[model samples]
Target: MKGILCTLLLLLWMITGCSNNSASNMENNKKLAEAVKQETEMPLEMPTDFNFMVSFGYGDVTKNVIDTYEGTVTKDLIIKGSATAEILFTADELRDIYDKMKTIDIMGPKELSKKGNCFQTPSNEDLWKVTVGGETKTFSWTDQKCGITEDANQLRELRNYIQHMVEGLEAYKTLPEAEGGYD
Candidate 1:
């Protein structure tokens, strides 16, 4: 009886320890990161035309996909839009983002792959929209290493590069420029 009880406790401890990286924890982290982003974004009057603007975020998920860092970059600025305001970024950082953007094969596969293993989580369904001549083009991609589809290998190199670019940009979060209330 004593040995059985000890083995049960050991199994419970192992399960608890592994839960730190469990899928539930991943979802929680994404939710918390999105909440923080919403609280800190800055406010700016958008151009009158939705016909010509820029935006970027995760693609279609059954649930809203949350990224640790996601936003849009224009010629002179990076704007993280939220209900409250926009968190502003500098020209240098935005410039780097744009440069990296140039290298990414944004033209993703014609269709996304189905989910991978039961334990597998798909990579960020990255999407970006840029407007040129009043027309907006949205590009999207995701990595599902389940081997169920050929796209798991296609654009693999660019996907890796883009993942690193987003993670690196986290360190460069600059000013949170809010709208002026000058009387």
Candidate 2:
């Protein structure tokens, strides 16, 4: 009878211990989830002295920022497809772009790696210049290898975001389209 009682007590103790550990594990999971939620909800801050320019086009025909309020975009044509106009950004928009750049650590790479094999001729180049505080960084990358690298992909996405914003502006809409095509 004593042996049976001891076995019953041992089983009960094991079950209680397991239940306590399970409860502790559940609490830990909840804490982890909350931390992740808070982190994702946090907004990224933009630098005070931020200025940036991103441009892209085929071959030598490209676009560039002339100043804070003006830029030019040349089409992929052999003749007369360039349009110079206002390219302005609001504080909130600039902050959003800066946040994305920071998230990808754009300034971290001096040159993006050309990892995969690329045999095709050069088709396009995308350029970026960012100034924060007193430091300025400029980099250019081609569409060679179809932007296979992680850095290239991220930059492409950033460039696309900028392009979408610019194209939606009234000033950009007023620009003339290309009249000719490359040979």
Q: Scored by CA lDDT, what does every candidate get?
A: 0.41, 0.68
Point to the candidate with the largest TM-score: 2
Task: Give lDDT tens digits, candidate 1, residues 1-183.
Answer: 999999999999988888855878899999987776554332232222222122222223312212313443221122333322223344554444444433332222234455655333533444445432233456555544443334434434444444444334443334243342211
Q: List model 2 lDDT by residue over 20-124, tens digit each.
A: 999999999999877765543323556566777766766566653333423443323246646677666788888888788878877665347575776445556
lDDT of 2: 0.68
Which residue runs of candidate 2 sit more than 4 Å off their true CA positions? 1-44, 64-78, 115-117, 145-147
TM-score of each: 0.30, 0.64
Worst ten in a row by lDDT for model 1? 45-54
